[model samples]
Target: MRTIESYLRMLLIMTLCYLIAEWVIDEPKGTVLFNPYVLGFLFFIFLLVISFEVIIGVLERIADQLTTPEQRVALEEAKKQKALENKWKKRFAEWLIGKQTTPEAQLILEDHNYDGIRELDNPLPPWWLYLFYLTLIFGVVYLGYYHLFGGSDQKQNFEQEMAMAKEQIETYKKTAASFVDETNVTVLTDASSLESGKSLFEIHCAICHQNDGGGAIGPNLTDNYWILGGDIKSIFLTIAKGGRPGKGMIAWNNSLKPQEIQQLSSFILSLNGTTPQNPKAPEGTLINQ
Candidate 1:
């Protein structure tokens, strides 16, 4: 029960941290609430916090197992004695310096006396020197990792990713043409094809044509009037060829398979007479029902 409670608490903390991080990063953008980068960063921060808590908790548990109450008391007493000895040593050193008039002590002191100013040359603390050395070691490790695997250089990573994507796209195009042959493409009016077409349209086309086929960048498909044509073949041809030059619709012949195009044409035909908000003014010949 305690373990379950801990897990639940951790989950709640992580959720709260994510919400806070998301809110902080998304403060500038008021219109759209969901930002992928913000969400990713929030998730990363939550994971980091969880990792830190787990590591510390594990270390504490290990420490508890290693040290008994008696051992802890002994350790504390030893630390106290060491601190007292250090304090006495400092006081003795100060007293000895006050009484120092020897040639060695005089030589150690500088003679640039102004009012009551004195300077002493002290060696760097051993702990500070060790810390400096550790910092240099850390720097070397960071540099090696970043150069080898992290790809800290943004331009290089961007170019590499772009190259990879381009290669993949080329391979896809080569395989795609076999399935999207223009000559062998047949019109689809079947229910299964129409459903597939609807799914594809929702994922790829809805951004421009909208969910209800109300046009934003593309023409409305629901009304009888069409921009290119209302007939299935003409619609398929227009989709294959794209809109008139410079009208923003690119030839989807490369992106979509021939059968998929037929399905999309069927789906468009299925949308006839469906109502949508802000439909564009009728532009093509009105196909009589």
Candidate 2:
């Protein structure tokens, strides 16, 4: 019995340590025995348990060798005394189970006999009765908290969470306009987009290209001639990445949102064929006259 108890205690300690390790390590893929850290922890636990058992076995052997016959008799007497001291614990266990009637004392019901087999009146177990009572109390509490009171139901909670999630998605959409790059960019010709683009151009690009995009320090945007290319994509890239290396126009990618850039690009394209106050001499290859 002692050996079995020792083994059970060691197993319990190992199980508790394993649970602690699992709680500490929050692995998204889920922890497994094969995981290096988990495997190492288990190995260490195994070694510790084995060492403990080995030490206990050696101590027991040493005690046996050192003990005299008279001491052995005294140890047996002490064990009996210890058992006597714990007699109440055994009685308490029996009390919880309730007293069972012996075969001789059992009352047989002759009226309930079926096929020559008589029925004995057996009471329900005390532990099971206690558990049933607890369940009844729990059910009452549950009903009072959720049904009687104004506690939100599962459906209401779900709807509220979904509403919050929907709001978050909407917010992300508004902010994610800046996530646009050269590949997915398209020309926006709406009045509002053009106005916004014009505003941005006046603030930033107007310094080099002049207010009318007729060219000052930069090449003329009103003309069809483009130093790079005349296409919308080419213009967008030029605006985002800048005119050329060591040249006048600096990259506006850091300063402007992609949506804003798209707007500016659209407004710049709208200037094609339109007259400027003082057009600079065409400096690049003309794609369209």
Candidate 3:
């Protein structure tokens, strides 16, 4: 039970450390910045490190718990002997190497050398050698998934999706246009339709036309003056096809559906007699009657 509690406490400390590391690594970049992707990556790495620590800790606790008192004493003695043996071996190797001439010393050196300094052809420690080999294998697997299997290049994928979305919107507009007839230009005098039109206009058209349709950038639609035309169909056409080329008004036919243009034109008709705070001076022909 004590061992279990100790392990839990250690795990808690490790978890807190992981969280701190993640927070430090993923902190905001700019003066008031935030980055979700960096935060997410930090969280992922944190989880991996915590998992490794927990597994190793649990295994160590179990091994310690299983050891008998006598066995523990014997194990300590064995460890001391092992340490002494390693120390002597290192000393012997250094002594033997020191006795050799520099030219003779190069005979036992490996082919790889750095700046005339040659590495001794000593065998790698087993643990380090295994870890190095495992890392190589991990690299191959990571490369296969992230590069070869298209795990990366998310920006390219997003651009492709945007293009596809644009294409679908164009296709829908074309299909909606085919359904329009002369009678489709119904006046939105009904309260419900006018309210709906107001909402849509506020979201999509308010920036240019102003909320009350007393235009800011585009021509004012309140007074009976037709930059394109004042009639329902002409209004619909103007709004749908947009104003003249190089004009600030873009082609709404691409952005808005044909039905939306009809509703918007109806809304404009409703605002014919209404006044706004800053009405642009009337342009185009004045429709008398």
Model 3, CA-based lDDT: 0.74
lDDT by residue (151-205, candidate 2, tens digit) is: 8989999999999999997777668865666766787888999999999999998
Q: Estimate each model's TM-score.
A: 0.36, 0.40, 0.38
Ranking by TM-score: 2, 3, 1
- Which of the two, 1 or 2, has more lDDT? 2
Instruction: Output the lDDT of residue 92, model 1.
Output: 52
lDDT of 3 at 231: 85
Worst 10 residues of 3 by lDDT: 26-35
- Using TM-score as the measure, which candidate wins? 2
What C-alpha lDDT values do all the predictions have?
A: 0.74, 0.82, 0.74
Residue pairs with clashing backbones, model 1: 180-258
Instruction: Estimate, for each residue in 237-273, the C-alpha lDDT of model 1 and write its tens digit.
Output: 8878888999877788899877778888889888888
Tens digits of per-residue lDDT, candidate 3, 112-177, equal 778998778654545566788999999999899888997757798899999999999777756875
